[model samples]
Target: MRSVNYARPTPALAIHDLRKSYGDLHALKGVTFGLNRGERLAFLGPNGAGKTTLIRCLAGLTSADHGEIFLAGQPFKSSEARQQIGFVPQEIALYADLTTRQNLEAFGRFHGLRRRVLRDRLAWALRWTGLEDRADDLVGAFSGGMQRRVNLACGVMHEPRILLLDEPTVGVDPQSRQRIFMMLDELSATGTSILLTTHHLDEAEERSDRIVILDQGMVVADGSLDELVEQSVGTQRLVRLRIDRPLSAPIRAGVAEHAASFGATGEEEISTRIDDVSDHLPGLIDLVRRRGYGIADVQVEAPSLHHVFLHLTGYELRD
Candidate 1:
């Protein structure tokens, strides 16, 4: 298998000036981004931020008013080009009445796989979903998580070069959500490019190689976590120290001239923002100790994806 995180000569999927509209309401406005080969990208947006619309446009489900899409360095046109992309919608698109094996068989055949290849992949899908023991069980009888796994297996049966997942773990429990990501990890290890949308910020923050945040149908932020933080939210860390008593006159004078603004929130609370913890925290501690002040506790909060998202978009990702 090709190494999962290696750089490629070109992006697996490239979208430029992708725009769509419904009457006067614009669903997408000049959206543009690229999905690097073998990289997992989080496409995030709030409700009605055009994430779903962009996905639909790329999947060829909904026509965009204007845009250019490229797959593997060529203009993305024709059914053959479409064949290189696999999309899993947020809804569980499966026949619940059908048995797990039956569903797999149907999906494989729909993908135009021959009997022998379909048969081999059927077993692989069943095993990959960890539903081999329940192969004959009806998908409707399975839990939401189980049904989701089957849904995922059906979409990827053809092993498309690019995978677009919409809310892959939306309705599932935590354990199943974890399992779903592990399954995606296996796919990524085989060098599949992934672009997934989810309401879960923590998952996006933790799982994605890069983040592209959309707001009001526009690409608002795009970069790694640290890059986003530095670009959108400054890198200063908030430090709050709870001491036993107020600072002495001498200690207050010593720290008053510092750029971090060592100020007392209360008789026992010292609050400041520091650029470097190792260089600043110990000095503050020693300064307090030398003055015979007792330390109670300390808290340091660095900027996170949550902070960057809020700063850039100015709205919590509701829905």
Candidate 2:
């Protein structure tokens, strides 16, 4: 096998103005992104939104009609580039007849590892994936989560600097999903740059350092979670209040002037959107007290990633 070097000091991955088309359908419309060493990015989009296509391009499994892809500051089509990157597909690709350890050994050898290196990788991978006890068992006998773990181990056994994962946690139980996230965190700590694509928005929100939201083969939003939420969703913050008595017309008009929109005297509570909740909340409470209304409760709602996606695309993230 080729000598795998984990100590290289290069930009983990880079893509410049990538474009791909299949007849009338444009799979990728000038998509571009770059990742530094040890960075973790989440590629998010709905079905047919070019997430898979972009992954395929990065993996060198699909050729781009236009644009350039680089790995470790070198052309991605080079053999060295292919050897320096690890790809874990959405589908579990493994030999059912082979034991988990055997599968890792086979892939390690395919990557040009010597017998001794392959043995060491096998042990490390099993331990890393929490499958050391199940090493000798055939992959066909393992549960879905166990098999998924093995699938991940296979990709990382060679210790590629850049790891590309396509929906790696799909169809797994909550426990397994959490385990996968933990393993990813470990990998990142060790300086492995990861580019993962998934529809699991909440998990992405928690784990990703940067979120890239794609729509119809275009990048609609890209930034930190808070940045995306603030940019896509309106700046106005929502505040809900429950008063002891109904409000009068003048007070309602005052609120309307200060707020973008408001509804009062509801069956449960009064909700309004204000530019600055911190400053306006006090005035609102004081007005209610002056009107002889008792304050029951108040709740403030800030913009979330879900709300950001909805506002930018006019559809839910899952849709």
Candidate 3:
């Protein structure tokens, strides 16, 4: 029989059975996940969730005691891995005295690019950051948004296959934040896998291709927002109403099972779970009229990551 070769594409990055600790405290516990080529993953966790520990391990800044990290399907080696990973820490990392071009050149050389190649990368970085006009100016003189661009541009001068970002838009204005994501979108077009950690729930929900939540050194949830919502909290939304005055006992008694719960509660505002807004909202409004209860206000809270995070991780404040 003729042999047919069927080769599988390697993932951009993978962590398997990862474990790390600090004395009696466990920093990571059997953590496992994968980043497909060109995928954008939002890594989320509350304070002290060991997010920093994992990022350090992957960036070669610190070693993991037990887990194996794979880059392009091969075991990680410091020298080889350096070229495959790019890290942009949350804090700005740049020399205040150095010009934008100078900083780019220095960072590019650090990653082993030299001579003509380094010059070409510098040109690319300038364009990528939209700081071409300010290339000759010291980075310290630039505004927060401009410096943030340089911070981001420095990390990608070598164009690694994987990027790790910690709050990539932390200090920039809204316009700059939008521009930053635009730059990220361009990088994504080139097949770079990104893993970012941020407390901005809205950004994670909208921008990330997938979400991985960590709590107490373990993976609590991993999936799209809808998928995680369905798994952890179900799809029901809460519909709340504040009545101008309480419903009389006779009116309360007349409420059917559907609207009865709305009146049974002793509070001025009552809420109910709804599966569909279009089908359920009209009836609820009608019930308010039939009972002669004036609705002062109404609110609907959808099932989202905010709910999911609190659901799986609990409401207790994390120090």
Evaluated against the true structure, the overall lDDT of model 3 is: 0.86
| Alpha-carbon local distance difference test for all models | 0.86, 0.81, 0.86
Q: What's model 1's overall lDDT?
A: 0.86
Model 1 Cα lDDT, one tens digit per residue, 21-92: 999989999998888887899999888899999998888888889989899888887476557888899999
Worst 10 residues of 1 by lDDT: 250-259
Backbone collision count in every prediction?
Answer: 0, 3, 0
Instruction: Give me the runs in candidate 3 sitting further than 4 Å from their true place.
Output: 1-9, 249-260, 263-268
Evaluate residue 311 in candidate 3 and report its C-alpha lDDT on the 0 to 100 scale.
Answer: 92
**Better candidate by TM-score, 1 or 2:** 1
Look at candidate 2 and tell me the lDDT of residue 113.
82
Q: Can you tell me which runs of candidate 1 are displaced by over 4 Å?
A: 1-7, 245-260, 264-268, 290-292, 316-319
- Native-referenced Cα lDDT, model 2: 0.81
Model 3 is weakest, by summed lDDT over 10 consecutive residues, at 1-10
Which prediction has the highest TM-score against the true structure?
3
**lDDT of model 1 at residue 123?**
90
lDDT of 2 by residue, 84-140 (tens): 788999999989899998999988888778778888888899999999898899999
If both were scored by lDDT, which would come out higher, candidate 1 or candidate 2? 1
Give one digit per residue, the lDDT tens place, for model 3 in 1-319: 1111123377788899899999999999989988878778899999999899999899899888898999989998977878999999988899989999999999999988999999999999999989999999999999999999999988998999999998889878989988988898789878888898998888788778889999999999987788899999999989988888765542342445643446553456767888998898878877777777788998999998889988988998998
Error of 2 at 192 (Å): 0.8
